[model samples]
Target: MVLVQNTNWNNAAKALKNISTATNFQLDKILNLSDKELEKLVMPSGYYHNKAKTVRNVLGMYQTSFSELKKLDTDTLREKLLAIKGVGEETADVMLLYLFNRPVFVADNYTRKFFSKYFKQKFTYASLRKNIMKNFAFTVKDAQEFHALLDVYGKQNK
Candidate 1:
């Protein structure tokens, strides 16, 4: 999945992983949780109430489930994801890539910095991610590794 090394990502992901593990990765069970409960579980994420609400709002859009969501064509799923109130491009792409095994590249700050600096070309989020995907065109694993390496190397340099 998304292996971004930002503190917020690390904390939030660990909290979510714990919750998913305890609930057997059942999105339904997660949705069934009370707002207060979900907030408490996600406290480590910061803005727990907001994040919990966002998670509920996004997940509520799904009528079926995870496997069913996976069955949807990537375009349809991406549209549905982007329609959510607070979900942006990177967020949507992260879910698609990590959760659904879609080969979409995630353009994060580290990615932008690394690419623009190394390539000596300023790039927009979509353009940079597209360039990375185009150049690495082959497999999802390669894209994941590239993103992870950018984060890892970015952290070290910082």
Candidate 2:
């Protein structure tokens, strides 16, 4: 049984339609592209192709390997997600942290720039993710919210 069945099919269909409208291609064609190739095809703002490829790969991985993702433990699922193409640590962490209610911090360019500017810290992406996770006593929601808040703060302060 699919734990989280495609309950949002209508929303997914609508989003697919929007992508189709914007890109002039059917959903199937979009899905056919690999992550890196798809990333090259789409407009930067759309990021749709990359996202679609990731979703397709992830769903296929879950269906084929685990039967249902909700049945897997958080760490197991994170590992599974990281194995897929285009599924980096941040993306996997975001999926675990938000979708699966796991405690994990996601760091992106905004977080890195904001923190570096204010804290005068120099760290690579991996180290930055680790540093943020170590320093913040925040839930997944808090991390998301804080990231948004930092983006706003940076924009205004700039």
- Each prediction's whole-model lDDT (CA): 0.73, 0.61
Worst 10 residues of 2 by lDDT: 1-10
Q: After superposing candidate 1 on the true structure, give the runs of residues whose Cα lies further than 4 Å from its correct spot.
A: 1-7, 17-25, 61-69, 133-136
lDDT, candidate 1, 98-151, per-residue tens: 777787778888778888888898889888777776665646777677778887
Alpha carbon deviation, residue 22, candidate 2 (Å)? 9.9
Question: In model 2, what lDDT does residue 88 have?
Answer: 80
lDDT of 2: 0.61
Off by over 4 Å in 2: 1-17, 20-52, 62-68, 71-73, 154-158
Question: Residue 90 of model 1: what lDDT?
Answer: 82
TM-score of each: 0.76, 0.59
